[model samples]
Target: MKVHFIAIGGSAMHNLAIALHKKGFEVTGSDDVLFEPSASRLGKYGILPAQTGWLPEKITPQLDAVILGMHARVDNPELLKAQELGIKIYSYPDYIYEQSKDKNRVVIGGSHGKTTITSMILHALQQAGKNFDYLVGAQLEGFDTMVKLTQEAPVIIIEGDEYLASPIDRRPKFHIYKADVGVISGIAWDHINVFPTFDNYIDQFRIFAETIQPGGELIYSETDEVLKTMVDGLSVDVNKLPYSLPEYTIYNGITSVLYSGKSYPLQIFGQHNLLNMEAARLVCQNLGIGQADFYTYLQTFKGAARRLEVVGKNDNATIFKDFAHSPSKLTATIQAVKSQFPNRPLIACIELHTFSSLNKEFLDEYAGTMDAADEAIVFIDRKTFGQKKIEPYPAEVVKNAFANERLLFFNEPALLLNHLEQLNIANSNLLMMSSGNFGGINLIELKNILL
Candidate 1:
């Protein structure tokens, strides 16, 4: 197969390119600019474009298919050329669906925890020596590529993102998957620029559940009231399975699950993670994995990258970095750390990076999200407002929105780092949360200093 990729430097796009290349397809890709990892990895596979930027000549009639990335604009030169030539174009998710149509598809969808849950399923499948294709969102510990495809694997695990599939494809990525087994961890309104309202954002998941293949299973978080209501309203013929946080106990920062009269320790913690584990368990059970085997394999799962990842630790302190920009994610992460280390002073820092998190309208959703922390700090780079074409709001607005008297807001990274350095780190835990770097702060250096 001959395939051309526009905006190929994207995290998911590049992985897809590599996956197709490994499957013996002729993959060619271009991007206006290629960053570190993507650039090197693409070059390693000998598919990196000789020059940056879209070249109309690269889009030709000879190509069998064109895969578009969300990074590509609607008027992207190559995309226009492909359209002009009447070449078939597909969003990444659409193409993924086409590739996995014959296989049993398992899609994990929600505003949060999808990546972690998808990673858990993949990890257990690998541990149990199951052959399967997968398309998870993050770089996992044992997986070579985020996208994998093979003729032999009868199943495909997908991390179902609610984001738009491509610039031209307005459907949520999950809607295109038509999963045989679907899992919704929870629903919290996000992507304000797209959906605009909480109800509208939730309707996407409702549609996702409706899209599942007939007689398939829908596993969801029973503890999420919003999700529970949605599930109750569904009129589909698919079987419904609801899961909640399993019985677990935390002792001296270690969490263990009590199941079948046995205690199984986990490398990951928190009610959110425990809930994620249950969702993965149900999905795997549908895929023919036994309960005992799932728990046994889950013991070594260290979690997906940037989802409560431990960056540095020592006898005095432990530093964690999480990709948590949404209001619900922020609250869950803060509560998890505080619950685990109840005796330690918790210093939780978060960067207002994503469009939703930085928007003035969405700020109120974060009310008391960080209240569990002994000290809460919110950082917003002044330049991000200009980049996002948003009028910057005063720090006081952020303070009032959070409704926390102890919340500290910073517009400067250096000052935030300075304050962090001055803090008494002994017997304390630092949780850094952001979808983007804290104004390019050197977290590893800070972690070393704090430790």
Candidate 2:
């Protein structure tokens, strides 16, 4: 098959393109611009575009299909050309479903923890030598790409995101997967620009739950009241399996899970991760992985990239970075680090990089979220406002929105770093959280200073 991608430089799109190329399909793609990792990975596979920018002439009818990306606008020239020629177009998830409809699809869904849960399942499956394909949000240690599609794998594990599929397809991506085994870790309102309202945002998950394949199993977090009430109230034909936080102990900064009277020590620790581990264990059970084997493989499951990932650590101090900016994620991450090591002084700093995180209305959602941190700091790079085309607000506005008088705010990277340098870091843990680069602040370099 011959596939051409429009706006192929996207994080998900590039991975799918590479997967198809590896699957023996003749793949070609175009993008307005490309960046590191995506650009270099595509170039290595001999699929990078000759030049940046759309070329409508490349969208000939000879192409078997055009995979559209959310990065491309509806009026994109290549898209218009494909439409004019009557060539079939597919959002990546739509095509992925078309390819995997015959296989067992296990989709992990939630506002948070889906990536970690999906990564855990993949790690276990890989260790057990199970034949499976997967699509996880973050890069894993053993995985080369975020997406994998194959003709022989009997099952496909998907991290089902509730975001728009493409510029033309407004339907949440999860609604298209029609999961045979669905997992909802939890739900917290996010994507302020997309949903506009909390109720509207949650309605997407409701729709997702209703779409699970008939007779399939739904493994959800029973601890999450919203999910528990929603899943139980539904009258779907699938088996409703509920899971909560498992029995675990944190000793000397190491966590161990007690199951069947046996203790399984783990390399990762956190309340949310323990919950995610339970969700993953249930999914692996559905896939025929025995109970003992599940815990055995889980011991080696470190975690996904940027999800409480350690950047630097020493005997006394630890420096971590995470991709957490939403209200619930920020709260959970801060609380997790604090609860794990109650004795250690934690300096939790976050950068409001996303449009939702910086929006005035959404800022209020984060009230008291970071109170668990011994010292809470917020950073919003002044230039980020102009780059995102959003109006800038003062540091006082942020401090007031968080409703914490002790919160320190910074609009400059130097000031933030300088503040870190001033803190007494003997036996302290520093957690720097953001979805962006913290305004080009080199965190590893900062880790050097703190540790």
Candidate 3:
């Protein structure tokens, strides 16, 4: 098969392009701009475009398919050419769904926890020597790519994102999969720029649940009241499985899962992660894995990248960085770090980088989100407001929105770094949470300072 990708510089798009190349398909791709990792990786595979801009010549009648990335604009030149030639242009998710239509699709969806739950299931399956294709959002330690496609894998595990499928196709990505087995981790309003309203945001998940193949299983987190209600309203024909946080105890900053009067050590922790584990366990069981086998294999699992990732640690201090900008994610991450290190004073700093997080109205949703931390710090760049064309928020406004008297806010990364450096690291934990790098703050340098 000869395939070309529009906007191939995207994280998922580039990975999919590489996956297709490895599958022996004649792969070609184009993009307006390419960033570091994507450019380097694509170059390593000898597929990076010689020039950085899109070329209409890349899209031809001879092309078998053109996979469109969500980053591609509707008026993209290559896309326009493909449409003119009447070529089959599949959105990234659309292409994935088309490829796995005949297979049993296990889609892990929700506003959060999808990546972790999907990673957990994938790790377990790999450990059990089970062969399956998968598409997870974050790069797992043992996984070669975020996406894997094969003609022979009977089941395809998808980390179903609620974001739009493509520029032209505005439907949520998960809805495209038409899952045979579905999981909703939890629902919290996010991506305000896309959904606009909370009701509209939630309706997407409803569509996901209703779209599941008949007699298919729906595994979800019971701890989430919103998810529980949504699942309760689903048709009785759909198999419903609810999960909660597994039994566990934290001792001296290490969390262990308690099962059958025995405490099994775990590489991951947190109530949210514990809940994620239960959902993963149920899904794996549905996929023919027993409870004992799942637990046995999970012991060796570390975690997905940037999801409560430990960057540096010493005898008295540990620092973590997490991809947590949404309100629920921010709360869960802080709570996780604090739960694991109850005795340590946690200094949790989160960057307001995403469009949703930068909105004035959405700021109130973070009220008390950082209450779990011993010292909560928030960072937002003034330049971000300029780039986003949103009104600049004063630290007072942020502090008021959070409703935390002790919460400190910084508009500058250097000042934030200075404040953090002044902190006494003895018996203290630092957690930097953001979907971005906080104006390109060097975490490795920060870790070096801590050490």
The lDDT leader among the candidates is 1
Give lDDT per model, in order. 0.94, 0.91, 0.90
Return the top candidate by TM-score. 1
TM-score of each: 0.99, 0.98, 0.98
Worst 10 residues of 3 by lDDT: 229-238
Q: What does candidate 1's lDDT look like per residue over 137-165, in tens digits?
A: 89999888899999889999999999999
> In model 2, where do residues sit more than 4 Å from their true spots?
none
Q: Where's the lowest-lDDT run of ten residues in candidate 2? A: 417-426
For 1-451, candidate 2 gives per-residue lDDT tens digits of: 9999998898999999999999999999999989989999999999999999999999988999999999999999999999999999999999999889999999989999989999999999999999999898888999999999999999999999999999999999999999999999998988878999988987888888889999999899898888888887898889999988888888988899998999999988889999999999999999999878999999998889999999998898888899998988999999889888889999999999998898888898999998889899999999999988989998788988999999999999888878887777779899999999877888787777767
Candidate 1's TM-score: 0.99
Which runs of model 3 end up more than 4 angstroms from their true locations? none
User: Taking the tens digit of each residue's C-alpha lDDT, what string does model 3 give over 127-234?
Assistant: 999989989988898888888999999999999999999999999999999999999999999999999999899899999999899999999888889888878877
On a 0 to 1 TM-score scale, where does candidate 2 land against the true structure? 0.98
Error of 3 at 128 (Å): 0.3
Candidate 3: which pairs clash? none
